[model samples]
Target: MGLILGKISVETPKYQLILKTADYEIRTYPPSVLAEVTYDPALLGDRDGGFMILAKYIGAVGEPQNSRPEKIPMTAPVITHSAEKIDMTAPVVTSGGGGSTPITMQFVLPAKYARAEDAPQPTDERVRIREVGERKYGVVRFSGVATETTAADRAEKLRKSLERDGYKLVGEHVLARYNPPWTLPPLRTNEVMLPIE
Candidate 1:
C-alpha cells in the first residue's frame, strides 16, 4: 500500500539501494531534515497522541516564522524507535508491549527543506527539527498490522541477517509504517530497520 501511495502521490525518503535479498535490503540514505516528537507511551495511553501532535504540526497547526501556520505536505513511512537508554553494543529488541518508556516518532521533511533551519517551526516545544547525517541501514519489509511484537520480531530477524552478512548493527531498531490506521492489515506496509556500519 505504501509503495502504491508513494508511487502515486506520497513522497518517501530517497535512498541508494546497495544490496537486496529475499529477507532484507541494505540501503544508504542522504542527510535529511525531520520533524520529530517524543512521548511516553504510558502517559499518552498509546502512541496515537504523539502521532497526532506531529500530524497537527504538518497540518499547519504550527507557528511559522511569518506568524501564520504553514502547511507541509505529508510524507510516507512514519518512523518510530524507542527513546529509552540501551546498550550501544547490544541489539535492541522491542517487547511490543505498552510500557512507561518514551518513544520517538519522526516524519522526514520534504527535500525542499534541505536543512533543519529551513523547516517551519513548531509552536509546541515537543516537536523538534533535527538534521540527520547520511546513514546506512539494513531493512526488512513485512505486510500486516505493525504491532510492537511484529516490529520486534522483524527487527530481530534483520539483526541476525545483518550480523551474518558481516555487518555491524547499531542504535535502536526503527519501525516504519506507510499507511493510515484504516488501511487493511494485509495491505499495510511496515519495515524494520537497523543502522549498520
Candidate 2:
C-alpha cells in the first residue's frame, strides 16, 4: 500500500491536440515497468505484445461525446478466460526508439464485456469494456522526457509520499504522459499516478 496524493493535472488537451501530445507521452515511458502486476503472460505473443485501447474524454464522468479525436496512451490488453481465444499484441511503436529497446507489458480492464462491431472479421476482435472505478490516487506532476528511469523514480517518490500521508496502495502505478514526442525531453509533461485505498 502507498500514500495517496491529491489530484494533479498533466496539462491535458481537449481535442486532436491531445492525440498528438498525450499519445506521445504515454508511449515515451516504459509501459512494462509501470504495469508489472497486471501484465498477462498469455497476451505476450511471440515478439509482438498485446495492449488495451482506452478512450478518455473531458466532461461529466462517463458521458459520451463526439469530441475531437484525442489520443491516450494504451496499456497492454489483458484478456480474461472467456475471451482468451483472441490474439493480443503490443501496440506498434511510432517513435522515440532509435537505439533504445522498447519495453512491453500487459494491461487488464476492470470487468466488463463487449463484442467487435464488425464481428467475424479476421482483424476485428471482441473486447471487454471496463469502467475505471473512482478512487483516490497519489499523483506527481513532472515535465521532461518520459524515460523509464524517470517514470519509475517519480512513481517511487509518489509512493513514498503517499505512505507518509497514510494512503493505502490500491492498484497499479499509472504514468500519464502529456507531451508531443517531438517536444524536447526536458519540456515534456508526465504524471505518475498510483491508486490508493
| Model 1 C-alpha lDDT per residue in residues 1-104, reported as the tens digit of each score | 54444332578899999999988999999999999988777777786557888888888344442213778888878898878766533333252136556788
Clashing pairs in 1: none
Name the lDDT value of residue 62 in candidate 1. 42
**Model 2 worst lDDT run, 10 consecutive residues:** 82-91
Candidate 2, which segments miss by more than 4 Å at Cα? 1-123, 126-128
**lDDT tens digits, residue span 91-123, model 2:** 112111222333332232212212222111111
The TM-scores, one per candidate, come to: 0.88, 0.42
Model 1 alpha-carbon drift over 4 Å, by segment: 1-8, 60-68, 87-97
lDDT of each: 0.79, 0.35
